[model samples]
Target: MATRQTLIEFIGERYPEIFALALDHMQITGLAVLLAILLGVPVGIWITRNKKLARYIIGTANIFQTLPSLALFGLVIPFMGVGLKPAVFVLFLYALLPIIKNTYIGIESIDPAAIEAGRGMGMKNHEILFLVEIPLALPVIMGGIRISTVINIGTATIASLIGAGGLGDFIFKGISMYNNNYLLAGAIPTALLALGVDGLLGLFEYKITPKGLKLARS
Candidate 1:
């Protein structure tokens, strides 16, 4: 279509800006993801040790999920100021639940018999937790990352509202100008980014799965 060519030309003309936008999205998403992992991994380990706390941990994350993204973003602005910092913080907060919950569930769901076998072989608790349990849990944990990344991509569109500048810039610009083309530019790229990242993570998950486990699944 003529519209498609025009859009491509527009993007090519602004390729650097588009690349920057993508990088900004990646930075915001990656920062959030990294922080979530730091927080989630430890909490997941702690939950394994204190079964009673698992409910509370998951319950707290669920509470965050219930709040609207806009509302959560608004709440953080007062303490964190505005723009990319606050936006990244919001994304990080949003990611925490999935990563933490999946991390805990993945480790917990791992076969107890395998864990016993490790212990029976005289492996220390830390050794078993890191060596045996984590390997088995990698797939599930990566699933959480996939989820969080997709969510971040969609949510990053709102980043421009706070001056964080991303693909959302196109969507928001289109809105102001009432230009359908601009909105499509933003929406399409963000959607593609989400899908692309999801596929990559899915591949990573498959690769990390143990060879023996692959047969078991089959």
Candidate 2:
């Protein structure tokens, strides 16, 4: 009870600062994930068309995924320097593998007979891709987006080290000062933000998923 009251007091005292930091955090995460979707989805779709390239492309993204977040940020610092650019770049790299891999997997997993049916119905390649393939593959692709969004939110805390200002400012400050209130202030919000975003995306995934897929899953 005391701890909860203390946290509430701390939040009350720092609400404005916390709100600003949260907005910064969301902006960084949103831009990174948006870029990942723009590039990753296309690359994913392209690799599906050229199976030989799938392994190599996915492999490269895997390398990015395996790199420690801090070290990746460090490496990027040389070219991009410390700021939103480098931070978003590193996060963008981190977000790529899941989105690309899931997209590829989702599209590839589609029944060939479905494609044949589309062709038999006089559908063009682009038409089949946009109308048939993408709709069928959306759930899996959304899964990737969800994964990437959550991961980005967590990792984005570290962006403060590069001068990108987010909740990590409070977190690192808490660490330096040994202030539990500060730690809780940052940590709790970050956790809640992740959960909130994931839940929203889950709802979106359900809504956009093909009705047939949902029925089949049920």
Candidate 3:
């Protein structure tokens, strides 16, 4: 009973500080994922317009995916320096592959017949893309975004190493001090944040998926 009370007191005492860390974690991750979507989706669309280039562009992003996260952060440090700038850049790179690949796949997967039908109706290329292709592809693209965001939540913890504070501050401090409560305090919240984002995105995915596609798949 006394131990339980102590634990409660411990969390209550640090709740404000921990909450601040969580907000930092969310802010950094949200910014990175947003940038990735903005940049990556366009790149994906452009690359698909040239099949020869798609392979090389996607190949390069694949290389970044294979690199160790810490090493990638280290690589960016010289150019971006420490703190939020470097951290956001590294996470942005980390997010690119999924968004790019998914966007490409989503767009490419559309039926040629459907595209032909659009052309027959006098739809311009851009019109077909915006009206037909993108709507159909959105679910897949959003899945990638969801995946990347969840990944960023966990990865953002490492940003603390570069002096970009987040929940990892608690994690590293706990590790250094051998405090289990502090460790759980950070780890639990991070996990919860990831799960929450995943769930919310999943709901959005369901909402946005085209009705015909949903029926076809069903």
Candidate 4:
């Protein structure tokens, strides 16, 4: 009970700082995921047209996925230097594989007969893509985005080390000073943010998914 009260008091004292840090964390995460979606979705679609390139592209993204987050951050430091740019860039890299792979899988998994029906209806390639393919593929693509967003939220804490200034500042400070309140202050919010974003995205995924797909799943 005493510890709980202490934590509450600590949060009360540091509310402004915590709010600002949370905003910064969200900004970094949002930008990284947006960039990933923009680039990844297009590349994912493009690779579908080129199976040979798909292998190389997905393989390269897999390599980035395999790298430790800290190592990737360290590698970018010399070229991009410290702060938000590098942090976002690293997070973007981390986000790419899931978005790209899921998109590929999503589109590729569509029945060939569906594409033939669209073509039979005299739909152009782009029309078929936008109408049939994307709608069907959306849930899977959103799954990747949801995965990426959660990963970014958690990883953004480490960005504080590069002067990116997120909840991680509190976490690392807590570690250095051995302050449990500080650790809780940072860790709790990060976890909450991840869970909250994931839930919201899950809802959005359901809403955007074609009704037929939902029925099929059911």
Candidate 5:
């Protein structure tokens, strides 16, 4: 269709800008992911050791998770306003449920024998977690990261409405102008960008995973 052709033409003409926008979006996404990991992982580990805390922690995250992203954005806007900072903050919050929950579930699921062995070897709690449990549970944890990333890619689309500027810029423009070509132009590139990043991160996950702990093909 002519829409597809025009999309290609427009992207070709501004590939660098589009690519830069993608990189920026990813940077924010990465920031959110990293912040979530730092905050979530330790809490996950902590809560896994305490059932009451786990329930409370999971419940808090569930409440945050249930709020629709756009609604969350709208709610935050009065205080935070439209900008990259608010967008990044919201993405960070959205990322916590899967990342924290998976980390807890994964680590909690490690083989008891292995944990006992780790303790018998004079491994401290932290040592066992870092050396034994994390490696063993990495695949599951990575799956959470993968899911969060892909979801964030889509969620980041809403950042456009907040004027945070990603490929959503194109889509928003297209919508405002009632131009189908503009919509297709933005949508195609955003989809491709998300897919490309997802594949790359998936590869990263596999490559970083410990050999013996590599996930089995299902």
Candidate 6:
């Protein structure tokens, strides 16, 4: 049984390695979310313009979301054979649904009058979408991104199963070694990472939202 001092000592000795794994975890999560946003947001926009395509694409994203994260990683292992590539790919898929769904909802929920006003000003479809619609919808879109990113941080911990090392490496090691301290070392940092990232994104969400909308809602 590891005592308090023992746990502290373990963490102290392993600090460098733990920090590296944490960085790896963040890198993987960040890259996966970035990729999902790049791909998912555009798809969401494209589909919203076509009901049939929206149904199919959003349905597919929903299906991907339904799968277990580990199971998805397992499925990818054969093709990518473990490490950052497969882990990022699986996380990217997991991150896509929220972003895609939110983007669709955000754009669709825009006031018709606002859209018409843009049109009345002689704005083209693409111009109105870029200048007017997207600005109004940014908060909702950012909210979805926040949700996806927080989820990815937690899920990235499991990437160690495929040797895609992260804080989960400490967790699995502790589990295998039956050392509570090891588990704490991994679990605590992972929790902190999730909370920190979520808070930062929340701030971004607030900042991006139009102040006029905030006042109107208030």
Taking every candidate in turn, the Cα RMSD to the unseen true structure, in Å, is 1.4, 0.8, 1.6, 0.9, 1.8, 1.7
Q: Which stretches of candidate 5 lie over 4 Å from their true place?
A: 215-218
TM-score of each: 0.94, 0.98, 0.95, 0.98, 0.92, 0.94
Model 3: CA > 4 A from native: 1-8
Q: What is the per-residue lDDT of model 4 for residues 1-218, given as tens digits with 9 covering 90 to 100?
A: 99999999999999999999999999999999999999999999999999889999999999988999999999999999999999999999999999999999999999999999999999999999999999989988999999999999999999999999999999999999999999999999999999999999999888888899999999
Per-residue lDDT tens digits for candidate 3, residues 43-114, read 999988988999999999889889999999899888888999899998998899999999999999999899
Clashes of 5: 0
Clash-forming residue pairs, model 5: none
- Higher-scoring candidate on TM-score, 2 or 5: 2
Distance (Å) between predicted and true CA of 146, model 2? 0.3
Q: What is the C-alpha RMSD, rounded to one decimal, of candidate 6?
A: 1.7
Worst 10 residues of 2 by lDDT: 180-189
lDDT of 5 by residue, 70-150 (tens): 999898999998888889899989988888888899988988999999999999999998999888888788878777777
Clash-forming residue pairs, model 4: none
| Model 4 spans with C-alpha error above 4 angstroms | none
Global lDDT scores for all candidate models: 0.86, 0.95, 0.92, 0.95, 0.83, 0.91
Tens-digit lDDT string for candidate 1 (1-218)? 99889888877787787778878888888888889889987898789889998999989988987899888888888898888899998888889889888988899899999999999999999999888998888888888888988998899888788888888898989899998777877888888889998998888888888887777778
Which model, 3 or 4, shows the larger TM-score? Answer: 4
Candidate 5 worst ten-residue window by lDDT: 209-218
Residues 24-60 of candidate 2 have per-residue lDDT tens digits of 9999999999999999999999999999999999999
Report the CA-based lDDT of candidate 3 relative to the real structure.
0.92
